[model samples]
Target: MDFAFLFIDWLGKPLWMWLAFISIVIALLVFDLGILHRDNREIEVRESLALSSMYIGLGLAFGVWVWWQLGPESGMNYLTGFVVEKTLALDNVFVIALIFSFFAVPRKYQHRVLFWGILGVIVLRAIMIGLGTTLVSQFSWVLYIFAAFLVITGIKMLWIGDKEPEIGNNPLINFMRRRFNVTDEHHGQDFFVKKPHPATGKLVWFMTPLFMALVMVEIADVIFAVDSVPAIFAITTDPFIVYTSNIFAILGLRALYFALAAMIHRFKYLKPALAIVLIFIGSKIFIADLLGLEKFPAALSLGVTFAIIASGVIWSLIKTRGSQEAHSNGG
Candidate 1:
């Protein structure tokens, strides 16, 4: 009983309704990509733009559904979660780009792996969000736990998040390499690539494109989760909103990855923006108890966060331009 209280959302929802909704979304994804998109070999620039537009439209349509069904507050929460999660998700793009460069993953097949990996992220985050909401709702003190984690992460980010990523070697990955007979060369058009040996007459060496990419994706997702999971608490503690918003953001990540891969680093100020977001949300939680401001609303938090992020982006662009101009003049 205590475990149930601690881990599960006691709020009862209908079984049939859950199945119907999940099935409908899954069916739509299959229809769009499998049926309508199966003939396409590569996603082109115009296609990426169209997909991005479709993604935004899809999210807006979901927001409209929320507003109609739940009311304005729910819709606001969804939007806030969407913005914060989406912006933070961009950092993951930069890391994945670095990883691809490190592993020398070719351009064409990149989208396929990212598309599948991001889908996995959406599903996994849904479970985590559900469990988190249930915990926060029941214990309330988990809010403090998230707060403490954010403050620590914020201080660390401020101190070192700006450092350029070093992807030379990870011990965990090295260990995996030693254990498995990795192919000397990439086996293409395959996520679960495997091969047999003539000498041994068995599976000698094997790997999928997703193999290395999934590790990178998982690590990136976890790092972002440190900020994103806590930040959503600022929007609303309802697990439903957090999960739904996260899914919407992640579903667009493949398109976002292709669209922004080349220019992500130009926003040199993104680290600072994320740092501030973490600190602000952490401080928001810390003060709730001391100031007795549990009535803190998600709407105000969303607006304030949006403003902070916008300012950071504009500043970064201006700085990047100035630096480029200086370099051009041989300064």
Candidate 2:
């Protein structure tokens, strides 16, 4: 149809490209909710792995499509951003797991909270990326600030090491408790339920722990975005590439969560690898300046980043193998 080809430019990208991306995403979500996860049940590691593989495959496939349509440079940038965002989101998986445990969210209902949470993330990420794109367009010098921020954040992560979050004393949890009516227990998958007010004896909606957990997870993603958004901006300021890569990475997160949470201990080395990745990405811009290069080669950047992550994963597996065996034996 002529309608499909009548492309008006949106943010330097054609309407058709945007429409294609949106179409794929919509199809994936429909498949995810309507078909694959038609019934909410406890997702075992095997099922999680299967779903994760599908999402990861689709994300990479989109990169291939980018390569074909937009040429190698943009394609490489998309892949780089995708890899960076996916790895950065690993840290978030830890916090989400903690929130779920603290709220005592049953496995069956966990998907429901996470599914609705995706809707929030789609809107939230769009706003952040749109703002970031605007800032970069208006003030080109902002890239330097992003680079500096990434370097500092990476160094801070190295210094602080990994520590489990203390959810019991989280200020947000405390604030929510003080400000609203919170049920003492989860009400199935419901985020809210109508119950009689203690003082007024009038029916009022009370938030369940599941809802609070969802809120906390959303907040956690926002916090992580502070690090991730800058890292992606440092990679390439293309709004289309940035947004697509970020959303694709996030689309798989819930599926990845089940598999990763169960074996989080095996990823002990991933944090340092991520820190190094951030530092490398941040430093590339400055390094290009000294070398009189327009920009670092996208292919080289992607290769180095992937190599670092692979090394970290392999080393973590080898180092943690004994501990895993010991735990199994003891059990």
> Candidate 1: global Cα-lDDT?
0.72
- Stretches off by above 4 angstroms in model 2 are 1-5
lDDT of 2 by residue, 1-331 (tens): 4685548889889988888888988898888889978887888999999999999999999999999999999999999999999998887888899999999999998888888787788889999999999999999999999999999999988888887779989999999999999998878878999999999999999999989999998988898999999999999999999999999999999899999988888989999999999999999999988999999999999999999988988999999999889877986
Model 1 ranges with Cα > 4 A deviation: 1-24, 35-42, 194-205, 208-210, 322-331
Evaluated at residue 275, the lDDT of candidate 1 is: 78
Clashes of each: 0, 0
Number of the top-ranking candidate, with lDDT as the measure: 2
TM-score per candidate: 0.85, 0.97
lDDT of 1 at 172: 55
Best by TM-score: 2
Which stretch of 10 consecutive residues in model 1 shows the poorest summed lDDT? 4-13
Error of 2 at 312 (Å): 0.9
Cα lDDT listed for each candidate: 0.72, 0.91
